[model samples]
Target: MDRLIYLDNAATTRTAPEVVEAMLPYFSESYGNPSSVYSFAAKNKDAVTGTRETIAKILGADTSEIYFTAGGTESDNWALKAAAEAYASKGKHIITTKIEHHAILHTGAYLEKRGYEVTYLDVDENGVVSPAAVEAAIRPDTILISVMFANNEIGTIEPIREIGQIARAHGVLFHTDAVQAFGQIPIRVDDCCIDMLSASGHKLNGPKGIGFLYIRKGVKIRSFIHGGAQERKRRAGTENVPGIIGLGAAAQRAARSMEERTAKERELRDHLIGRVLAEIPYSRLNGHPTDRLPNNANFSFRFIEGESLLIMLDMKGICASSGSACTSGSLDPSHVLLAIGLPHEIAHGSLRLTLGEETTREDIDYVVDALKEIVARLRDMSPLYEDFVKKNRQ
Candidate 1:
């Protein structure tokens, strides 16, 4: 059997061994509920508290400000919905970018249906939002602004600090979905003036089904979940003790090795992109060259569908994605791709390959070779390619 070359780190990461080790004991002997009064439970509660403190320190946020949630989606939904409800009297208007994760875009749409007005900001060709545009979009009724710290599909890092400053100038609440950027990049919420931030554990090599929301102290946000005293009543239900512990361990590892990991990943990612463009004809890189995630490399091959390319790569034991996996079953191109001015056909041909801690130069080379072959075969079969060639020959 061929070994799988997993490159879809932006979609989700394989849990780290250290993180898995940290979570094991909680699932067995230390399974006591954190809310219980017994000694067994007290130990679990303390662990949870310690994890929270660790996460808080990493983000440079107050310990009291972080609230655990199921994942990035939940955090996004809660932040947008809670902010709208909590500050309804101030305004019912929100601002966000068109290239945001579906978690934020869909939640904003849902709020729109519920009488809130939402302004979808456009991104430049490089998939970057203009802070000036955000400032101009602000209205007296605007109560919140949510933008992702880094684009998941194209991997373009936004000017979050500038946008946060614009939001603050307008006295509007600012929320950023940092699910892809949190552990991968150096993020200090205080330094960035980010009032709210959301992150998922699985994206950072931790267990799935656990994430956190950083709500700056004094930010008005209502409860999204009800019934339990968990998460200081901001989020309900019993704690995901094991997953949280894994997230903490992952965060700690990320904090310590961020610089080293980032440098290595960037080197490999750039090499992959350069090799693919040099080897494959009619292929172009997506997203900003320098302002992209260190681990992300997205590209578009003219004339071939992304899904077809993905399937071909998968058959070659190369694991990659056509943008968001959640939207995979749909035949439509990703919203992120389309928003960046790609035509429907070009957008449909995009591929995202995200590296991680385990990714090696050898793995990248293998995937690049596989991609060059697969794209050539797919393009040869494409009628559009034939037409393009015929026209160019004239």
Candidate 2:
């Protein structure tokens, strides 16, 4: 079988071998309910605690403040819903950017349906929301402010620390969907002045089905899941032992290798972006050049559909994504791309190539060469390209 080049780390990542190894014992010999009191469970419980502590330490958060959830979506839901309910008496308004992940956007919409007022702030062409915009959006009735640390599609990193400061001055709770930024960037809850944050394991080379929400010590939040005494009574369900173990291992590795990994990915990402834009006709970059994720490279090619490009790339043994994997099946252009001021045509032509630790320079070069061929071929079949050329020549 031929090796396929993977460049969709933003959608999800391949689980690290070390992460899998750490999870193996929990799924096999060490299998036990962390909530159980028997000796078999006691060992599992210790493992869970250790993992929790390790994650907390890495985030500069308290162990009790970290509530494990199923993944990023659940964590986003919990944070938004809990904030609305916890502060309903004080206010019923929430503010968030238009470019946030669907997790936050959909949850905010749900809150709006439930009688809460939501303010969707607009983003710049680079897909960045200004901190001042968030500050100005606050009202006397504002209860919380939610924004993503980094965009999943365009890879624009928001000014989260500044936004957090604005939220703090307004005495409003702040939550950031850090699923795309947590392991890829340095994040200190206190330094950022964030009240709550959400993360997923799979985005950071850990196993899927496991994630966490960081709730500040004094913040009051309602539980989304109701069940036994688990997750400090904040979240309820049988603990995902193996997934959590994998997440812990992934987090540890990320912490230790972050600087080196980031440098390498950035180098490759920038090289790919440069080469693709230089080699492909009518191609433009989609996000902030310097303030974006080290692993992300988004581009728009004129006169070709993103899905068509993805299919052609796959045929060349290169794996990439047109946009968010969740919305890939839908015909609608990505909300993130639209929010960045792209026209429908350009938005539909966008492609996201996110690198990971396993990605190599050779793989990037292969993708660049393949994309050059595919885009040229696709453009030849496009009536829009022919029309434009005809008009320009005349």
Candidate 3:
């Protein structure tokens, strides 16, 4: 690993040095419980408040609306489950996209077993869900609509504002899992008409194990975690003072440099996509061509498996993924690719390369060169590729 290149920012990012520096003091010197009444711990409470304010301002939300959680998983779970419980009297019907992360999908399943009806809407070939379809699926009993702001696997940005408008017009609460979209793009809760949103800290160069759920005022959601009065009595347990500080520091840094950072990432991403598509035969890009995260470029090289591609890339000091980091280990192809109408063989060969602020044109070029060789080697060993070549020659 003499020349290491990390292109898996969507999976997680290296915490910024500034974020670490801000959190260090909270971990040691001023780490008293925020819940404590003593003046010594007052700073901890103030720190949490300040972090909440910083995060809320970024999303155009009120400070009281942001509730800290363990991470995106917890925030997503809390949003769906607690909303289901609180709104049960209104209706037990919920609507969501099929391409959502497992946090939403698995929680939807949990709700289904508890006697709720969930409609998993399909997306287009570009992985964009139609707002018309969402409106069409709306029922008198529909209580909530959960959609991801941007897809975690393919990096496709959904038509969230349109969907949010539909939800609002239907008098249904809308919750977006903004885990991948928060730091990468601009979002305004009020402008989008989003009633609730979930975001994680680690995705944006913040420390892991910290996230927040934004519940619009008067959304009427109940508590998910049962215990003390933390998170304004919505989520329970002790506050993570260090995590809060880190999340704030990361958020501020991301805001100040988002435009410049994403511009560079987008350029690098397109360069990677362009070179790979031109240099490699039978390689297809996944997700929307333009309406995607600036840092994301996913592709499927026919006649090669994703795991083998990842292994070869690792050998070349490159890091990437086949799909969502949470589900990359599964044998089945990505549901996102399948949803976008990719066949099993092609979907099985998908590769996801998510760029970061540190990624450069040199890095992208190196990855493309490695991929060209890797795909050629892998296909050379494939009997299916041989059969196709023979048939074409005939």
| TM-score, every prediction | 0.98, 0.98, 0.99
In order, what lDDT does every prediction score?
0.92, 0.91, 0.94
Number of the top candidate by lDDT?
3
> In candidate 2, what are the lDDT values of residues 223-261, reduced to their tens digit?
888977788887888999999889899999999999999
lDDT (Cα, tens digit) per residue for candidate 1, span 127-214: 9999999999999999999999999999999999999888887788999999999988899997788999999999989989999999
Model 3 residue 323 distance off true place after TM-score fit, in angstroms: 0.4
On residues 1-394, what C-alpha lDDT tens digit does candidate 3 reach at each position? 8799999999999999999999999988998999999998998999999999999999999999999999999999999999999999989999999999999999999999999999999999999999999999999999999999999989999999999999998899999999999999999999999999999999999999999999999999988888889988988899999999999999999999999999998888888889988999999999999999999999998998999999999999999999999986799999999999999999999999999999888888888988999999999999999999999999
Residue 308, candidate 3: Cα error in Å is 0.7
Clash count, one per candidate: 0, 0, 0
Pairs in clash, predicted candidate 2? none
Question: Distance from true position, residue 86, model 2, in Å?
Answer: 1.5
- Model 3 stretches astray by more than 4 angstroms: none
- Distance from true position, residue 231, model 1, in Å? 1.2
